[model samples]
Target: MSRRPFLTLPNSHFFLASRAAAVVTTLAAALVAVSVSAPALAQNTPASSAAAVTGGAATYDTAGASAVQPDDTNNFDARQKDLDRRSTDNNYRYAVAEHDCYSKFFVNHCLDSARNEMREKRAVIRKEQLALDDEQRAARAQKRDEQAALQRAQDAADAPQRAANDARNAQAYQDKQRQHALDQAQRTAEAPQRAANEQAYQQKQRQHALDQAQQGIGASQAAANQKAYDQKQANFQQQLDAARQQGAQKAQQRVENQQHFEQKQATAAQHKADVEARQKQAAEKAREKQQQQLQEQQQQQQQIEQQKQQGK
Candidate 1:
C-alpha cells in the first residue's frame, strides 16, 4: 500500500488568511455603516440650513442692489446664532465620526466624508453670516443717509436766517471799518495838537531850568517859588474835592429821579387796573340782569299759552 503525504502550510500563512478575511468583513461593515449614516450626518442641519443659504443668497446681494427692508432684518440674530451653533455642532460631529473611523478598516474614506460634510455645513453658515452682515450694514447706511438728508433739509430751511445773519455781520464789519477810518483820521488831525503840546512841554521844561538857575541866585526867590507851588497844589485839591462833591450830588439826583419815575408809573398802572376792574364788574352785572329779564319774559309767555289752552 502507498502512504499519502499531507501537505501543510506555515502558521504565518494561516494567520494572514484569517486576518485578510476579518479585514474584508470589517471593510464591508464600515462601508454599509457609512453609507447609512453619512446621509443622516450630512442632513444634521442640512434641510432647513440649506434652504436658508439658498434663500438668503438673494438677500445678500439685494442689499447691494436695492436696499434692505425691515422684513429682512427680522430674526437676524436668531438665525445667525442658529447657524453658529450648527457650525460648532457640525465640527464636533465630524470629530466624533473621524474618531470612529480610526477603529474601522478604511479610515481615509470616513475622514473624507466627515470633512466634506463639515465643509458643507460651514459653507451654509458662512453664507447666512454674510447675509446678516450685509443686512446690518445696509440698515446702518440707510439710516445714515436719512439723517444726512434731514440735516441738509434743515440747512436749506435755515438758509434765509443764515444769510440774514451773514448780511448783518457784513454790515457790522463795515461799520467797524468806518469807525476805524474815522479813528485814523482823528489821529491824523491830532498830530498838530500833539506837536504843539510837545513844543509847550519843551518850553515849560526850559522855563523850569531857568527858574531853578534863578533859585540858585537867591534863597528868597526859592522860598517864593515854593509858596507858589504850595498854593497851586491847594487850589487843585479844592477843585478836585468840589468836582467829586458835584458828581455825588448828580448821581443822587439821578437816582431820586429814577425812583420817582418808577413810583409814578406804578401808581398810574394801579389806577388804570382799578378803573378797568370797575368797568368789567359793571358790564358783567348789566349782562346778567339782561339775561335774567329775557328768561322771565320767556317763562311768562309760556304760562300765557298754557292758560289759553286750558280755556279752550
Candidate 2:
C-alpha cells in the first residue's frame, strides 16, 4: 500500500489534465453556439418589431423600393379621394361664388369664361352624341320630306287627270240629255203635224162625196131645167172640190211649219242644256283648284314651322 501511494500522485495529475482538456473543448463549443445564436436573434428581433409595427398583416407596396408606412399609404389614398371630391365640389362652388370686388362686366366675364370652359368640355362629348342624333333625325326628316314630296307630286299629277275625266263625264252626260230633249221635241212636233194632215185628208174626202150627191140631184131634175140645174150643180161641185183640195194643201203646209218649229225648239233646248253642263263643270274645276291651293298653303305652313324649329 505504501508503494501504491508513491505512484498514485502522477495518476491524479494525469486525470486532472484530461479533465481540463475536456472543459476547454466544451467552453469553445459553447462560445461557437452563442456566436451563431446572437446573429439569428438579431435577425428575428427586427422581423418581430416590423410585424408589430405593421399589425402582422401584408400590404401592397405602390412605391417600389421605398419604405412605405401603412398609415401613410392609407392616408395618401384617403387624401387623394378627398382631393377629388373637393375638386368636384369646388366646380359647383365656383359657379356660385360672387366676385363683388370686380366690375360687373369683369365679374360676368369671369363667370362666363369658367362656364364656357366647362360647357366646352361638355360640348365636346355632347357634340359626338349630338352629331349621331342629328344624323338620325335628319335622315328621318329627309325620308319624311321625300315621302311627302312624292305624295304631293302624285296628288298634283292625279288632279289634272281627275279633272279631265270629270270634264269628259260631264260633257257626255250633257250630250245624252241634249239628245233626249231633242228626241222629245221631235216627237211632239211630229204628233201635231201628223194629226193636222189626217184631219185635212178626211175633210177633202167629205167634200168630194157632197159634190157627187149634188151632181146626182141635178140629173134627177126635169129635162127642161135639167140642163141648167146640171150646169149650176156641176159648177158648184167643182168649186167645192177645189176649195177642199186647197184646204188640204194649206193643212199640209201648217203641219210642215209645226214640225220645223218643233225641231228648232229641240235644238235650242239641247244647246241650253249643254251650256249649263259646261258651267257646272267649270265650277267644279274651280273648286278643285281651291282645294289644291289650300293644300299648298298647309305645306307651306309646315315648312315654316320646320324652319322655326331649326332656328331654335
Candidate 3:
C-alpha cells in the first residue's frame, strides 16, 4: 500500500501564542517606525520635489535667479551621505527580516513578502531624499535672493557716504599739492634773504671783534669790550640757530603732511579695489551657480528618460 506523506503542525496553543507574539512585535515595530518617519515622509514627497524643480526651471530667466541656487558639489555630497545611511538602515532591516522569515513555517512566502516590503521602503526613502534635496535648493535660492536685496539696500544707503569720501580724498590731494607748491616757492624766495642774513651776521661779528681789539686803552677796558663782543656773538649764534631750527621744522612738517596725504590716498585706493574684487567674486559665484543648476537639470532630465526607458 502507498502511503501519503503526513504533515506535522505545532500544537494549537503554541501556534496561537507564537502568532500573537509575532503580531505584537510587528505592530510595535510598525508604530515605532511610523512615528519616526512620519514628519520626514510628510515634508519630503516626490510630488513636492517635482514641483520645486518645475518652479525653479520656470524662474530660471529671472534676475538674480542664479544667486538663489548654489553649486551642487556640497549638496550632492550630502545627498550621497544620506543615501548611504538609508541604504545601511535598509540593509540592517533586511538582514533582520531574513533571519525572522527563515524561521517561519511559510519561509518562502515570508521571505518574498519581507524583501518586497524592504524594496518599497527603500524606494520611498530614496524619493524622500530627492525631495529634501530639492527643498534645500529652493531654500538656498530664496536665501540668496534675500541676501542680494539686503546688499543692494545697504549699498544704496552707503552711496552718499562713499561719494563724500571720494570727494574728501580728492580735495585733500589738491590741498596737499597746493601746499607743496607754496612751500617750494616760499623756500625759493627766501634763498636770497637767508644769504643776506648770513652775510650781515658775519660782518657784525667781525666788526665787533675788531673794535674790541682796537679799544686797548687799559687792561680793564679791553676786558669789558671783549666781554661785550662775546655776548653779541652768543646772541647772533642763538638767532642763527633759531632760524635754522625753524626752517628745518617747516621742511619736516611738509614731509609729514605729504606722507599723510599719500597714506590717505593709498587707503582709499585699496578700499576701492576691495569693493571691486568683492563685486567680481559675487558675479563669478552667481555664474557658477547658474551653470551648476543647468547641469543638474540636464542630469535630472536624462535620469527621467532613462527611467522611462527602463519602465518600458
Candidate 4:
C-alpha cells in the first residue's frame, strides 16, 4: 500500500493475464453450449440429419433425372444409319476391287505379274469348264444317233417274221371253213347219188376251199405284208425323225462347240494380247524406273559435290 506503482507489476504481466482470461472465457462458452445442447442434440440428431440428407438426396435425384431426360433414340438411329452407309461403301469398294482384279484379260496378266497364284487356277478352271461342256454335247449327240439306228435296225429285222406268222394263221382258218362246207354238201346229197355227188361235191368243195384258203392266205399275207409295210413305214418315219433330231442336235451342238471354241480362242487371244501388253508396259515401266534411278544418282552426285564445295 505505499505509494507504489498503481499501474500494476509490468506491461508484460498485464498482457499475459488478459490473454489467459480470453482463453478461459472461450472454453467456458464452449462448455456451456455443449451442456445446453447435449439432450437436444441426442433427441434431434436423427430427425435433423435425416431431413437434411433427404433434402440433399432429392436434389441429387432431380439432377440425375434431368440429365437422363434428353432423348437418345434419334442419335442411336443416326449412328446406325452411319454404320450401314459405311458397310455399303465397303461392299461397293470390295466389288469394284474384285472386278478390277479378276474380270479382264489385262487384269490376268496384272495378277500374274503380281504373282497371284489364284488367277492361274481360275483360268485353268474356266478352260476345263468349256472343254467339258463341249465334250458333253458331243457325247449326247453321238449316243442319240446310235440309239436311233439300233431301234430302226431292230424294227426292220422283226417285220418279215410277223408277216409269215399272220399268213399261217389265215391259212389255218380257211382250211377249217372248207372242211365245214364239204360236210354240209355231203349231208344234202341223196343215198344212191350220194356217193358220186358227195364225192363230186367233196372234190368241188375241196377245190373251192383250197382256192378260198389260197385267196384268204393271199389276202392275209397281203394284209400282213401291208402291216409289215406300215410297220416299216413307221419305223422309217421314226428313223427319219430320229435322224432329223440327231442331225439338228448335232448341228446345234456343233454350233455351240464352235462358238465355245471361238470364245476360247478369243479368250486365248485376249490373254496373249494382255500378256504382250503387260510385257510392253513392264518394259516401259522398267525404262522409266531406270531413267528415274539415273536422274536420282545424278542428283545425288550433284548434292555430294555441292556439299563438298560448301565444306571447302
Candidate 5:
C-alpha cells in the first residue's frame, strides 16, 4: 500500500485528519492547562519531610509523567510531600474548573468534562500513592525480618551460658530443698519430746509454788517466785523462737516452689479471695472478743474505784 501525503489525501480523508488534529491539539492544550494551573494553586510546604525513613522510593507509571519527579530512594519523604502538594493542587484546580463550568451554556457537559479530567489526574496520584505504600510496607517488613534474625542469632549465642546457669540453679535449689525437708522432719520428730519436757518443767514450777504457799511465804517471796516463773517462760519462748528461725529458712527454701505454684494459682484466685474473706471475718471476731475483754477489765477497774471512793 502506498502512503498518501496529508495534502494529497481525498476530501473526506482530509476532513477526518483535520478533526483528528483538532482533537490532539485540544488534549495537548488541556494537559498544558492542567500543568500550569496546578502550581498556581495556593499551598505552603513545610521545611522538613516526615517520610525520609523510607528505604526506596517507587516511581509512578508513565501516564503520570506530568506528576512531580520522585525523589531518590532515601528521599521518599520529599516525594511524599510533592504528591500531597499535587493532590491538593488537583483538588483546588478541580473546584475552580467546576465553578467556571457553572457559567458555561452547556453547564452539565462542561462539568462532566472537568470532572473526568480531575478523576484522571486523581487516579494517577492514587496509583503513585499505592506504589509508595507498598514500598513502605516492604521496607518495614524487611527491617522486621532482619531484627528477628539478629535476635535468633543472639539467642543461639547465649544458649550455652543460659543452660549452665539453669543447671547450677537447679542443683542449688535441690540442695536447699533437701536440707529444708531434713530440718522439717527433725522438728516434727522432736516435737513430742519438747512437749514432754515443757510439761514436766511446768509441773515442777507449780509444785515449787505450792511448797512456798504451804510454808506461809510472805507477799514479797510470792512476788519473787512469780518473777522467776515469768523469766523461765520467756527463756522457753526464746528457744521456740530459735526453732522458728530455722523453719523460716525452710520457708524461704520453699519460696521458688511457691512462685511456681502461684503461676498455676491464677486459676484459683477466686478461691484464694474467698479464703481471705473468711480469714478477715475470723480476725474481726477475734478483735471483737479482745474489745469485750478490755471493756470487762475497764468495768472492773471502775467498780474498784467506786469501792475505794465509798471507803473514803
Candidate 6:
C-alpha cells in the first residue's frame, strides 16, 4: 500500500504581514527613485522607449488639399520644456515637504509619507506627458506617410509639365549667361567706386551693430538687477513662511503636550481612587469576620453555662 503525504496549512497571518511589509518597502524605494531620477529619465528617454509607449495607429488631421502634419520636433520640445517645468515645480513642493518632514516630530514617518505622495504625483504627470508624446509621434508619422504619397502623385501628374519646364529653363539659362557676361563687364568698369561705397556701408553697419550691442548689454544688466531683486524678495517670503510654519508647529506641539499631561493626570487619579476603594472594601470584610468570630465565642460561653446549670 502506498503511503499518502500529509499537507499542513501555512501561517496565513505571518505570510500576509511579511508580504505587506515587502510591498511597502518596494513602494518606498520606488518613490525615492522617482523623486531623484525622474528628471534625468525624462530628459534621456530614447525613441525606442517612446515607440513602446505609443504603440498604436496614428491619426492625422487633413484639411483642404493638403495633409497638415504636426511638427513632431517642435511639439516634443515644447512638451519636454513643460515636463521640465512641472518636474521643477514638483521638486519644489517635495523640497518643502522634505524640509518639514525632517523638522517634524515623526521624521521617518513624515518623510516616507511625503515621498509616497510625491511619487504618485510625479508618476501621473510623467505618464500623461509620455502618452501625449506617443500620440503626437504617431500622428506625425502618419502625416509624413501621407505627404510622401501626395508627393508621388504630384510627381506623376507633373511629369509632362516637367519636360516642358526643362526646355524653357535651358533657353532661359543661356539668355541669363549672356546677360551675366555683359553685366560683369559693366561691373568691372565700376568696381573701384562700388568697392569704396561697399566699405563705407560695411563700416556704417559695424557702428550700428556696436550701438545696438551696447544697448543690449545695458538692458541685460538692468534685467539681471531686476531678477536679483525678485529672487531676494522670493527668498525673504519663503523664509517668512517657514518661520510662521515653525511657530504654528510649536504651538500645536505644546497643545498636544498639555492634552497628554492632562490625560495622564486623569488616569493616575482614577487608578488611585480604585486602589483606595479596594483597600476600604478589604477593611470592611476583615471587620465583619472579626465580629462573627466574637459572636460565635459568646454563644459557646452561653451554652457552657447552661450545661453547668443542668449539672447542678
As for model 1, its CA RMSD to the true structure in angstroms is 31.7
- Candidates 1 and 3, the one with greater TM-score: 3
Query: lDDT of candidate 6 vs native?
Result: 0.59
Q: After superposition, how far is residue 143 of candidate 2 from its true place, in Å?
A: 1.3
Between candidates 2 and 6, which one is better according to TM-score? 6
Off by over 4 Å in 6: 1-41, 46-80, 160-312
Predicted candidate 4 versus true structure: per-residue lDDT over 1-312, tens digit per residue: 123232322347676567456645654665555445433332231111111121121111111112111353224334333323333333333333433443333543543433333333322222322222333434554776688578668757976885685577557656755765675466456456746864785576458546655666777776666677578668867986997698588657756865675586577569758966885796687568657645654664465457558646
Clashing pairs in 2: none
TM-score for each candidate, following the candidate numbering: 0.38, 0.24, 0.62, 0.29, 0.40, 0.31
TM-score result, candidate 4: 0.29
Query: Over the stretch 227-271, how does candidate 6's per-residue lDDT look in tens digits?
Result: 775786688679869976986886577568656756865775697
Report the CA-based lDDT of candidate 3 relative to the real structure: 0.66
Best by the lDDT measure: 3
Q: What is the C-alpha RMSD of each candidate to the true structure, in Å?
A: 31.7, 38.9, 10.6, 40.0, 30.3, 47.8
Q: Which is the leading candidate under TM-score?
A: 3
* lDDT winner, 2 or 4: 2
In model 2, where do residues sit more than 4 Å from their true spots?
Answer: 1-124, 193-312
User: Candidate 6: which pairs clash?
Assistant: none
For model 3, the superposed segments whose C-alpha errors exceed 4 Å read: 1-96, 190-217, 308-312
Tens digits of lDDT, candidate 2, 1-312: 011121222346676567456655655665555445533321221111111121232322221212335565434334333323333333333333322212233444554655555444332222222222333434555776688579668868987886786577557656755765785688688888977976886687568657767777454454535466568668867987997798688657756855665686577579758966885796687568657645654664465457558646
Tell me the deviation in Å of residue 89 in model 5.
1.4
Decoy 1 TM-score against native:
0.38
Residue 205 displacement in candidate 1 (angstroms):
17
Better of 1 and 6 by TM-score: 1
Q: What's model 5's overall lDDT?
A: 0.63
- In order of lDDT, best first, we have 3, 5, 6, 1, 2, 4
How well does candidate 5 score on lDDT at residue 165? Answer: 68
Per-residue C-alpha lDDT of model 5 across residues 1-312, encoded as one tens digit per residue: 132232332447676567556655655676576566554332222111213212343344333444444355445676566676667666656766766654445656666777877876765565456455445545665776688579668868987986786677667767877987897799899999988998998899889889999999999989988998899889989988997897687687589676775564554566657866885796687568657645654664465457558646
Better of 3 and 5 by lDDT: 3
Candidate 1 has an lDDT of 0.59
